[model samples]
Target: MAHLALYRAWRPQTFQDMVGQQHIVQTLQNAIRENRLSHAYLFSGPRGTGKTTAAKVLAKAVNCERGPSQEPCNECPSCVRITAGTVMDVVEIDAASNRGVEEIRDIRDKVKYAPTEVRRKVYIIDEVHMLTTEAFNALLKTLEEPPAHVMFILATTESHKLPATIISRCQRFEFRRVPLEEQTARLREIAEQEGMNAEDPALAYIARLSDGGMRDAVSLLDQIASFAGGNVTLEQAIDATGGLPSEQFARLATAVRDGDVSAVLQEIDDMMKAGKSADKCLEQLMHYFRDMLLAQLAPDASSSSGRVADPSDLRQLAAGFPREKLFGIIDTLNRYQTEMKYAAHPQTMFEIALIKLCTASGETPSVQEGSAAGASAGGAQAGVSSGEVSKLQARLADMERKLEAALKGGGVAGGSTSGASASGGGRSSGVSQAPSKAPRVRVKLDPFVAAHDSPQSKELTAKWPQVLQRVKEERVTVHAWLVDGEPAAYADGTVLVAFRNTIHRETTERPANKAMIEGVLTSVLGKPAEMVTTMQKDWQEALASGAGASREEAAAGEELRLVPEDGTEPAREPIIEEALRLFGEELVVIKDD
Candidate 1:
């Protein structure tokens, strides 16, 4: 006989031999004993949870020569033939390969005939979700009302993809993943049966790596046993799986807690040089920290089976991490792990995440705000006193008051001290004068409004939702501010967005925010686009003031032209001329009040 893989060799032949799914086994056994079997059955769960195994066992139970018994007697010729797949009435179909309307139609045709070789003609369709829409429809009628001598069993890892109509016709049973302890015991049982020498921790580690899949755990144990020449150890298991030891993760965590970037990076570099994958390393590290967190939060609770570290060591490590810092670290690791899934250079992302953890404070704030006081107060560090923070806040409030007064008094066009002092009439000498706030630079909307009904403008309006979606994907904060704005007009490779809220308009006009929005627009619109923001009220006022005059007026020699009192154009300020020259006449307009 050829060598049999451990998974297949140890396949559960009876419900009594199966592990970690007692609920399903007991139910099926009672149903068979009482003769209350459904015509169609749907077994759904993660891989290696005994879906297919249960199906085969049920088939044998229903057709065993002794009787239609709850347990199939392997000695009986009927059970033997079914187990060997020599029985003509028992059919196992790989739906993934034969997922077609024709194949399902063939099954529909064949299901009507009586069983030729057994009491019940059993059909087991694995990965039944792979069947196409037409195939599912074809199988529906037959599955709902099969012949009295037939039973249909469908198995799939993903049950959500099955159509509602098909799902409604079957009796569904969800198989749960095997628990860690049960899986470990199964591995130990297999090791002892095969006369392999394996340490307890090595078997447990293999079980943990399998993530609750019995077949995967057994296969890994077999592979590691072969690699270790039949004597498996923890180190051998780790080496075979490319897994890092708990000690390495502890050292890395210590470096991060101590804010030692060099040590963290060096450790990562060494691991990478040893052929460890960045993503796998990150995943292990995340689990290690999770174990530590659990240890800290619930000191009385027993340790997780997957954690190989000693309880004392885990408690000691957990002591160094505060609850809040642990949360932030976990959150950062999770975010970076998600990004690394699509990253071309995952190692760089991994390194950056570690470096971030090294430098982050215990109470890492998600959003950072920079104030004038923080900028002016040089040498400010985390050790700054509460009194100092209060003083800075007071200073910021005073500056804001002065700015409000300056705006109300029409101080100046730019932040000019001389202009502010000259404009501060009847103000108290004790009150410091703030520099005038600069006038907002707005896009000249005459051309845009005239072409507001053009194809480009309409296209932008149609694709505005896509732009908002892309913005949300890039930075949700930007989207919160940009969502209030609408594409008011488009002209000359520029998009004019009008905002209803002043704060939203100002925030959307920030250089960084504007650049990100423009990038999203360019990608979605398939053209180079620039975004200019203005208040919605201002845009409406401009449209009302003849800015949106029909193009036919200009074509009929009725152009609206601006002229000075002396029959020549008025001279513009040097700054205004420069602005017009740089932004174009259609995007820059002088506003004097």
Candidate 2:
């Protein structure tokens, strides 16, 4: 006889043999013993969690000749035939393969007939979620109102895919993944029974690799036992599975914490040379970091049964990393993992991710303990000194105060000095002098008011979104600054925009940014145009005061005039005007002696 795989050989025969699902087992057993069986049942859970096995066991229990008992008498003809799958009444269907409406219609037709060889006609449909919509519809009526001698058991790993109508008709049981301890113990029991020499660590590792699936753990153990000729060791298990040991992960993590780029690259190269795929290496490293985080957060509650390394070593390694740094590392790994999926050269992507981790700010372990103060100090040292940051903040506050004063004064302090004065006594004078103030550039609202409600202004408003999009396409930085302004008026080839944010208006008026916006507007509007910006509050005040030019004055080319608070126009040079336009009234601080 051919050797049966351990998973099949060790399949659960009854509810008593099932692990990690006490609630489900007890519920089913009580339903059977009390004669409260339902016509249709839905079993859903992860694979290898005994959904199908429990269905088979329930079938045998209901059909046993001596009694419909909690436990099936395997010796009875009904139980034995069902266990061997030789009974004509017990039918098993793989919905993945036979999921058409015709097949379901056949089942619907057969469910009406009485059992030929058993007490009840049992229909077990595995992967029931794979059934087509039509197939589900076909099975609905039969499942809802089957004959007294018929029972339907629907099993699927993904219960969400089943229709609500089908689910409502059945009694649902959820099977959970077998826990680590129970799964490991099962592997050890199988090893001893099969006369294989497997170490406890090897069993634990295989169990962990299975990710809570008993069949997967058993199959892995069988494969490793065969590969090692009945003597399975941790090294042999790792090699056979192409998995990295805990020590390698520890070394790589340590290198990253120490900011050792060369060491990190060398470790990746060694792993690549040893047949480890880049994506797999990244996945394992992510898991290792996750374990480390969990260990630190819940030290006593963390279990070491399936960890790659000892709990003490993990805690020790975790001490070197601050929580914030660990968060950044995990985020980087997650981002790179997503990108690596579609990358043509995964190894290159992996290397880049490791290098980023090594060089990221505050990645290196602090010289002192991993406290908040130490972390902050380390970050400051890595980027900017705290003293310099404070000085910069103070200067910014002073500038803001001066700017507010200037805006309230309704003028910008001018800095332009006459060349003759600069060449002579200006440089030799020892006496200090107060700064001179330049006149504010007051926009004459006449032109704007004359054209504010014109057809051109309305057209510009309609196409404003398109203009912003074109600006974004041409230069995103300009768009970011320009988006805050709205079209207020259009006149004499100049588009007037009102901005609520002073800084945005100032930035948008810079030569390069203004040129970019003008180019986009010209292209989008199909006409030559220039842009002029004003503060929204100022525009509102001007409109309320009715301070605007008449249509005749606007047509005569009166647009903007530089007037002082005393209402006198100053003789300003072109360079000075350019400076005022670029820096705005708030930022262009002018000093004179």
Candidate 3:
């Protein structure tokens, strides 16, 4: 006999032999036991999920010579004939090839005849979704009213393509993709039965790569088994699946987390050169980050990832990435994954996504702000002697108390001074010093209203560069974001800053960033102040009626102005050349209010 595929050789002979999908099996078996089988049944699911196998099993069970048994007695002549495809009573048709009105008409004509040998005539149509509209219309009436001795089973991976009329006539059972554990266990049983020596990890990896498809998993095992001479290892499985080794993904992720763009690009180049699909590479990266996320949230649940990463290493790696960054990474990858589907050069798209991830993580305030402190504090909370953490925490508590006291008017007041200071060295000159250990009175300054008129707006406009410089001196990332925004309105103590993009607006609106900018405003204007951030669109909408054709309009309508860093317009592309190439122009628009 010729060599048979493992999926065919180990096809489930009984309902009990089926893996996963117990719900469908139980219902079919109970129907056979009760002799209440439907006239037409639709078995729909992904490939390799046992739809055809299940249909065959149901046929054998109903036609078994002994009785309508819940489990097929494969030893019976009827069962053997059906299993061997030799029974005239049980017919299997491939709708994919023979999908025409003539084929379905033939089925309709044959359904009226009584079985020659078996108890019932079973017609199994595979890929029934491929049936043309005319073919479906021809089969509809016969399927709805089949003979008492006839049964129809339709199998399709895509049930949605089947017309509602055809679907309504049959009992639809949707088979689920087998779970990882189930696939792995079944593969292990098959390996032992075939006398193959395979590691559990190898089997698990094959199961994962097969993506919950049993036939695919078994086929992969057969291929790997032949290559490894019946002894399969994890390396052999990984090589056969063309999967990036877990170590490579871990290395790439580390580079991304560390903001090593060169390392990230190099890893991607290596992956591309290895014949890995760009889409699959991104999928693997997404899965890797997903595992990292799981490890961060619930470490025990991460064992399902099946990666060989050390638990301690995984935890440490996860510690470096906060939940927010991980979420952003996954979201960006997902969006780009969709874009890559239609892209001509998928590899370039993948590289662009990686670079964006690198920069985004590097510039994120949460990541950048905590990185130095995390390193200095030692090992993300462990390397510090417990006593040191306690002392630092105590100092923080004392500072909090002092801040609360000041805010409540029992300590030093908070405000910024300007170069336009009063004589006698500014406001501190004549104030009497408080007694030691006393909670002295502190005066809160009245809130300053903003001025949207010309002079105040121009003053703010002129001083914007100074404010940004002060911001940069205090927090470089905040300054980098703030440069995209211009002063839109300045009133008593509140300055409305308009940002062309939502990212810069949101970044500047963070409480810490807001406080920083407000401090800058106070120092530049010689009083306590606040800064209100808005997107340029919203600012424009507000000003379209009130400040008609104001400085904002004049600046935006003037000759092109760059954001000064990357030479692109404010809140636009990071690099000007890319924007020029994209738009085929030398000028880029900017909202320079």
Candidate 4:
């Protein structure tokens, strides 16, 4: 307890000592000069960004021996005790610990008194957001009519939680998280003072890891210094942080750039074996990939020549990937992150991810392109071409076999191919298996179908309210999902019920289940849409077809639609029920809800 942590020891005692927030300091200083300070002030911002520090400094400045001056002469008994937090007049309270209404009431009662031993009574409440609403209301009235000798300095990391009415009564100052450049410079100064030789890149790395918080950066530096004999080398920094060296990540990125899945996988395995976390590695790669994507798609981030961090390695990887392939890889990684989030062993996630990423059609765009080149070369005929052409053609033909081998071999890129062709430069975008053609049987809806509205159709109508709107507006795409397709009727008398197949026999989809269908259908037709649904067979031939294929993508919604907005309907897969396809286009029309 005798030795303070570096963060505490280096705590800014005066406005001049604070970093990255001259604007806030200048305003506070001017306010003191003009004697325009508020009776109650709210200091709010991110942690380590000086909200508490600013509050304490402001308190010291106000109670300084020399009339409410900007600078607190630390030598004054009042200043010294306040700084030491030993003064009876300057009370520092952790609202987090004393948030009950009774505690607030005690403060309310005490506020009427003058300073106990200083010029003014300063009540500094840290984490004021923790105060209950009742506590806040009690304090609010007291604050609005505080003694002239009393000042309140309320600091909170989350100002949003404070009651707006309370906030409106106090002068508020927002502290922002420090910027990277500021953090980097501050870390450099700290390292210099410690007599440690820290590289610029290493310092930059720490600054970034700190996420624009000077205290965090200093703490990390202190950690690195203690663990690495007081000299924080870049390698030591990466080792301590499990941040894979930029060099190694760059190498892996290079392989990705070259469209080498095998190399990418090998690199991942090697990193994982080195005790670097697979999840962390994936996260780093994600960040790197994001930088690259920005560099690839945005002119502003294109070059280090123009920007601070070029994200070159990533840009190269992105450039090597086709647009579609890039998007696909991103999608796959997103899915992987979601699924493996809670997995106990993340290593397996990346172990499989590396394998998948290498041969992954999306991330492995270059590989596919190379494979296309090889396949084109191998298919070369009596009219075929040269050495490079043949090599590429050969690769194309054996891609699946090669990919399968890579997956089994921890993701090696260069496998000796017996079918090697002497070809190159024949790369294509993607090499997905051609989907066999399926007949398009366009079933048109009856012209009479308006925005359908019928009480019986209410259930189905309510199911996809968004889709109904889109269909009526003739939006680019729309597909009615068919979870259950059956006929049901209910209206004082008879109703017809039919299902597509035994599979569609679920009671939910069954028309016999009267509660499931009939809604706004009548609104569209001015009468009840006599609900009639029956399972129907595929009417196509050449190859005997059945009802619509399961997993039918709704074509009603526009392509590349946004992932559903918060609380909105999801772009879900259409259900595979028989009655749905039977009456697919002829289901009750839509009308206003």
lDDT of 3 by residue, 463-512 (tens): 88899888776666788889899887655445677789879887886656
Order of models, best TM-score first:
1, 2, 3, 4
Clashing pairs in 3: 448-492, 448-493, 449-491, 449-492, 449-493, 450-491, 450-492, 451-490, 451-491
Per-candidate TM-score against the hidden true structure: 0.68, 0.64, 0.62, 0.60
Which stretches of model 4 miss by more than 4 angstroms? 1-4, 255-262, 294-335, 351-356, 360-593
> Which candidate's TM-score is highest?
1
TM-score: the better of candidates 2 and 3: 2
Candidate 1 lDDT over 50-96, as tens digits, reads 99999999999999988789899978889999999999899999999
Residues 1-593, model 2: lDDT tens digits: 02238788888888898888899989999999899999999999998788999999999999999779999988988999899999989999999999999999998887878888988999999999999999999998888778999999999999999999999999999989888889888888899999999999899888888778777888899888888999999999999889999999999999989888988999999999999999999988988888888777777754543356545558889998889888888899998888787666899989999999987743222312224433332344335566544433333333434445556886432221221122211211111222244444555566787777789889999999999987775566678888899998877777888998999998997656876787777787888776767889888876676554566777686634323456765454333333345446434433222
Q: What lDDT would candidate 2 get against the real structure?
A: 0.77
What's the lDDT for all of these models?
0.77, 0.77, 0.73, 0.60
What C-alpha RMSD separates each model from the true structure?
Answer: 11.5, 13.3, 16.0, 15.8
lDDT by residue (tens digit), candidate 4, 1-593: 11237678678899988998999999999999998888999888887788888888888998888768887777888888888889888889999999999999999998887776888888989999999989998998888989899999999988999999999999988888787777778888877887888887777777777666777777788777776887788778777777877667667666755657778778877986788777777777666665556767773652322112346545555676566655666666766665466555677776666557665544334455567545543443333456635544443444445554566877423421110110111111112211122121122111112112335435444443542443233211111223334223222211233345545333333322322233333344344433333333321220133223321232232121112225343221121121123224222111100
Residue 359 displacement (Å), model 3: 0.8
Off by over 4 Å in 1: 1-4, 305-313, 362-593
